[model samples]
Target: MEFKYSDNDQLSVSSTREKIQEEVFNAKCRVLTEIRECGQLCDVQIRVGEESFPTHRVILSASSPYFRAMFTNSQFVDPNQQVIQLEQVSADTIRSIIRYAYTQQCDISTENVESLLVAADYFNIVGLLSECCQFLASQLSAENCIGIEKFASWYACSELEQIAHNFFMENFVEIYRTSEEFLHLEPENLCRVIASDDLNVKSEEIAFDAIIHWVDFDPIGRTCYMAKLLGCLRLGLFSTYFFVEKVKEHRYVKDNTACRPLIIETLKFLCDLDRYADARSLGNFDISSCMLTPRMPHGILFVFGGWNVNSPTNIIETYDIRSDSWMSCQTAESDYRAYHGTCVLDGLIYIIGGFDGMEYFNSVICFDPVKQIWLEVAPMYSKRCYVSAVILGGHIYAMGGSDGHTRQSTAERYDKNRNQWSFIQPMHQQRSDASATILDGNIYICGGFDGVTILNSAEFYTPEIDQWTLITPMLTPRSGIRVLTYKNTIYAIGGFNGVIRLNTIERYNEKSKAWEPGPEMSTARSNFAIEILDDTIYAMGGFNGHSTISSVEYFDIDNEQWYGAADLNVRRSALSACVLKGLPNAKSYVPSRSRVPIMDASDTVHLKDT
Candidate 1:
């Protein structure tokens, strides 16, 4: 504690000398810091074998520890001394060496990578040597792999030499995107880099850039790659109008010439978008058109009949929303029949009680569009045509059909699960060709000609009570009219009142138990197809009394009016209509709007294009 000033000065001098010595040593091992342009103030000399190389000549960050260490003892043998000179190696060559040494503690830069790699082979830095081998393998080129192999073999870097040989052997044909100082590889390594899964490039620009490289640069090799990218984009999930408008507003001009592959991929993506958009709406198929059979409470639209002058219309004709076209489906029916009762439940279409133009059919035919098969179920209690079949509480309620002799007050129930029919309480009046629809879990049967005359009385049947209750009468007595359900309300469109073909339209509210007039059809037609698709009521091909017309019309329930649609592909009534299927997760069932599988003629008729 009582040291003299002279002793303190001597101690300070010793400490300064030690600091100077430490700085000198550190500078020797890190002389490249001088190149950083004043970032480091240390002065040092770097020894490379017998020569000193100034690091200030290289352009690199002075703060980089790697840059500092690279120049400290960088060396290669000289011909004069039988040692290699690593300074003679090109930047491209050093890249391979540096990359190899990075994974190991060994220096793999041109000056040290090869020598350390050789040392690793002899000194058994197994993991270190292994990293060098992988580096050499990764950097192998078609023109240089053999030379690298030869060098590795001479230096006893057997693993490195083998790696180089294997790399070139497997990836000799790889195409690489190259720059003056960089190389982005193709094929295997490129796939691995782009598909690394750990890459965090979330920007669309970067992702699209990567995608373009794969798609445009090597289309044949990147088919699956582009497909996966498009799938991920799922461009269709975006609203079409919004996407199109955005693209137009941005004036995004694609590189058509250079981006042919990208353009193709984009087009495919757009197509998928349109397709799925339509498919999404199919599940909500509410209304399309309606038609009437010849019997009461049972008279529903017979949708399987239509005639085309240009082609034999054996297929089903459907209403197309986009084009307003009547798409003819020649395969709607397995057998030629009209005046049939059609009902939908659990995605299956059940056709019951129709005339095949030859005989009154009592057999219940169930058509499955998914399976493309038709099954026959138990016959009704009495053979009925113009019979009403309504689905309530998981059972089909069959009411009133004639046996070509007399209309009966008959009612029966068909259990879907059991595939059996049981007798139910009959109606009060003997009625046939009656329009019936289910409302509030009750069957409402209206207006049909009894055996003697056209009856105006309507009745409601309760499945729970197994009884029919007489309800209010319609404004007009009509038979062979079409009935539809929309938003908890029922609508009757077009009918014959014994003396005239009427275009009158009526709406019924179950709550009020009354019928009211709505918009009438443009054409006064009878025996027409009226259906519901897309929640709108469509009036399809029907007879106008003078000739069979191809006129088609649709009703706007919200607007409470009818508008013109595409005419039927053919001009025949007594036809039926149903929806089509779509891909999984698809919305609408229309094939035109969706990317549906291309169906052949045979398969075309079997599928329901919802």
Candidate 2:
């Protein structure tokens, strides 16, 4: 290759010299390293603690702004000065850093990371500073994340500070439970964590407990911070029993004048929740009342592709338990199907076997929540609607459904890695509208119509033997029922009992080997989407024996009853719901929180009027 002079006499490049430039850079680094090691022509000595390192002035100046300013400006350095002293950085840290000035390489690890970050930033070594920050960011954990966040912020490492802060909030529960640094956080940092809408707590009780513990750690120094932190909790969420016995009666809360108003406001909200629920139902409620607003949940519940208003709908939505709201997600353009079954496995949401309108489909669609795109996975062996779907042993099992023409007893499992569906041992009965769940290492499916009869029989399949065993039948001949497994207990609820739509609930007693009656749901409905959120069972939109309804409610085991939740935007029946946990961008699926906790609860109230 050659270069030539242009008409204007400027040299023009004829070929790329990228490879040659890289070799030249490597040669310069090697020669510099050798010279520094030999101490031949070293112009400066860096003294830290009891050690002095011989270094080249030109090399340090070229590598860092801190050195460049000292060597160039008299205000920073004397021309006759031959040595520099740094009391903040240890000699061991400078040795590696100085070596990096010559070789452009340094060893960074957890042991030396904090020291390296401090020294690298102090010396204004951009490359080394970046490496240290990256290493620290990767090493973020619940045990040390609070320390990392504090240090990163103190050092003005903006990017690392933000990452560490987000990690602390996302893993808040674990950090609070395990991190010793959590108790030592300054009031402002502690306030920020609790006030964040993204704080993940199954119940507000955890937040309440955290503040008490934190304040009690240094009672004299921290008691004054109780008011500031107390406002950060969603106090209206706690029952009156817990509030009076645990919070309102706590010495820190009861004795503090500033916390008294918040305490009173929360009591008002608790007494009037039913009234507020009515107002919220009519769209007249203020969701901005911080005490009433829910914190952002880490897991989002998805309800997609359902039978709505006498027809199939492709509308997709997610239930944010924290906010008690349903928000729509992007839908597949032409893939409207209903009576389908869905499950989340390996981060992809699978919609298997369902009917569109006139035709039954054996197609499978996978939704990539991050990409917001729908992709096709392997289809099932049979076209199915009213299908039973469960994820077991990392495989998605599609069991009996109608397939439009007839009830199918055929079963198949799809392997996502192979992109293939293999036939599995079929169920004993040709059942449609049967609900299935993975319980105790087996696929237990129960209650469905078998063409001529509404079957009360339930059965479980063991993959190891590829066989089905009949369990004792339910006391009632129920079809279209939903079965859920939680804490090793199987709960069966709401369905047609061959005579009428029933909301009666029963749980399978594993020891008794029989279905024992449990508390009934608030609404009697059939063919609804049921899922567990916040450790409770929420049953969404379905038929109420007359027409389709949009009512939603959750059953609380401790209270032994169902409570109303936000209703669906549109009426739905034969819908499928799946719980998608630990979504990286969970906020994208849930409602955006505009306000934090009870600061507004106290501000908007006039307690004296009472």
TM per prediction: 0.48, 0.68
lDDT of each: 0.55, 0.82
Local distance difference test, candidate 1: 0.55
* Residue 184 lDDT, candidate 2, scale 0-100: 91
In model 2, the runs with Cα more than 4 Å from the true position are 1-188, 202-206, 234-250, 257-293, 330-334, 594-610
Candidate 2 pairs with clashing backbones = none
Candidate 2 residue 252 Cα shift, in angstroms, is: 1.3
Ten contiguous residues with the weakest lDDT in model 2: 601-610
Residue-by-residue lDDT tens digits, candidate 2, 1-610: 1111123112123123655777898999999888888999998899988898888888999899999998999998896788898887887899989988888889998889889988988989999988888999999999988888888889899989988988887788778877789989989988988888778776678887778778878999999988889888877667666778888999998889988888888887776664443433425445576776778786789888777886898788888776567887643332688888998989988888888788888888888777677777667778998999999999999999997779989899988756789998889999999899878889999999989899888999999999999999887777778999977899888889778888898889878898889988879989999999767888998888999888998877766777787788778898888887767788788766653222222222111100
On lDDT, the leading prediction is 2
User: What ranges in model 1 sit over 4 Å off?
Assistant: 1-302, 306-314, 330-332, 579-610
TM-score of 2: 0.68
Tell me how candidate 2 scores on lDDT: 0.82
In candidate 1, what residue range of length 10 has the lowest lDDT sum?
289-298
Clashes of each: 61, 0
